[model samples]
Target: MMRIALIGTGNLAIHLVHAFETCNATQLVQWVGRSNTPPKQARDTPYFTQYQNNMDTDVCIVAVADDAIPAVAKELQHIDALVAHSAGAVSIGELEPINRRGVFYPLQSFKKNAPLDWKSTPICIEANHGDDVILLEKLASQLSGSVHQITESQRLQLHTAAVFTNNFCNHLLGIGQSITTKAALPFSLLHPIIRDTFEQSFASQAVALQTGPAKRNDIRTQQKHLSVLSEADAELYRILSKSIFNTHNT
Candidate 1:
């Protein structure tokens, strides 16, 4: 079994701990955090508040914050085992002092205390050497069926796209919920429509499936929507309406 040491106590680290528990080929040897308070989920695993240069492990995963990754990598440079970070946008070169360095980025937003299906998650990996790449891929494949070798630049682009697809869309859903609540209507009423929109988006271009006052350039209906919204919501509505109109009309 491949012994692994994880260095972080954040959401991603929690998810990784759970994933490792499910993988028979891997054993989580240690979990390093800033405090001695062991992660609630990793109660049985060994915990360390400081980096131990002598810890023997097949792989050491640095799952810290993006900005802290470089410092963590530099600190763990003395270790002989392969060191990898879990940042999508951070380059592998951040681990400059370490000869054996790699990236094992999981392309999904992690929430604390939430259960995740590791099998369906996509893992993006990169390494300084070809053999290290193979080793990283082998380890990632145990947790995810879709393991991709993506460059740092490509990973950054993917992360940007994810913000648009996931974050931005979720924000819009929140706005929709607020509108429904203000109108004293159940937000559940929008569930079917939201589900249909996603289902249709997969079958064709989103622009082609668009059907709203903005898509039809119905200024009267747009003005009606703006009249009912608060100042902030009205401004947002105006901007989105104009964008939708311009996208299809211009």
Candidate 2:
């Protein structure tokens, strides 16, 4: 069995704790947080408010903020174990001073109290040594079905793509909700169309599936939409409409 020490108390760390609990081959030896407030879900595991220089674990997983990774890693340098950080955009070099370094990035947005299925989540792993890479792969495989070995550059690109596809799309959905609410319509009314759009996008190229006034270059309909929206919404609509018009017609 591989003993693991997790360092963080954020959403990602919570998800990792829950995921590790289901894997019999892995044991969460310690959970290090900035405060003494123990996570309810990690009641069985030992909790420490500070980093221990000589942790007896196979690997120390730093699941903290991107900016805090370097300091956390420096503190763990004295430990004789593989050290890995869980940041998609942060490079493996941040874990300097430690000869054994790796990355264990989960490519998904996490909510504080949300539950996620570990089997479907994608895990991106990177390491300096081949053996360390294999070890990380083994641990990741136990928690997730989709695991890939990615370089720092590839991981950064994937993270940027995720922001565009997931974050930007969610913001657009929020705008849609606002429009519906203003019109005294239930947000549920848009659920079917939203579901279909996502399903279709997954089955085919999103660009090919594009529709509406912008895609058709219907200037009159685009102008009418802009006229009905608030100033902020109107500006956003104009920008997106122009982008779609240019994308399809030019």
Candidate 3:
């Protein structure tokens, strides 16, 4: 079995450890971290808190904060193990001078309280060598069927798209919830609409599935929605609606 060293004890690392442990072809040998540590409940095997002791593993996966990745690479410069990081924005060049480097980015939002099926998550991988890419693909195939080779530019584009789809969309939902709550209506009323929005897109292309006053160019209803929202929310609604309309038209 190929030995693995997991660096960092964050949410991503936790899920990865669970997935790797269950994969028969790989052995999750060590977890390296600084003062931060995964909770006792998360510990299924031995883990080390120092970098020096982490050198024994065959592969080193740096699943730390994006800012810390360079430092991790510098600290482990002497070691020849394959080094990889879980960053979407940072390019493979960040791991330069390391004999073996690759990207093992899992494209998904994670919450510690939520249970995840690793099989459902798509893994985005890239490497300098065909062999390295194949190695990553084989390892990622153990957890997920959706694995793809993406260039650094493509990965950055995907990351930016995720911010709009996930983060910005969630903020819009929060605004909707707050508006409903302040009007003495249950936020649950929005649930059906939100659910259908996501569900329909899964069955059809999101652009083809678009619907709303803005999508139809129904200026009258759009004005009514703007009047109902507070100053900040109204501004946000107008900007997003304009952007959506522009996007659909173009």
Assess every candidate by TM-score. Answer: 0.94, 0.96, 0.90
lDDT digits (tens) for residues 102-150 of candidate 1: 9999989899967788889999999988998998999999999999999
Off by over 4 Å in 1: none
Lowest-scoring 10 consecutive residues by lDDT in candidate 3? 35-44
Give candidate 3's error at residue 6 in angstroms: 0.9
- State the C-alpha lDDT per candidate: 0.89, 0.90, 0.83
- Please rank every candidate by TM-score, starting with the best: 2, 1, 3
The prediction achieving the highest TM-score against the true structure is 2
Residue 140, candidate 1: how far off, in angstroms?
1.0
In model 2, the runs with Cα more than 4 Å from the true position are none
Task: State which candidate, 1 or 2, has the greater lDDT.
Answer: 2
lDDT of 2 at 186: 100
- What stretches of model 3 exceed 4 Å from their correct place? 36-38, 41-44, 53-55, 248-250
Instruction: Indicate the worst ten consecutive residues by lDDT in candidate 1.
Output: 50-59
lDDT tens digits, residues 89-208, model 2? 998999998899999999899997877988899999999999999999999999889999988999999999999899999999999999899999999999999999999999999999
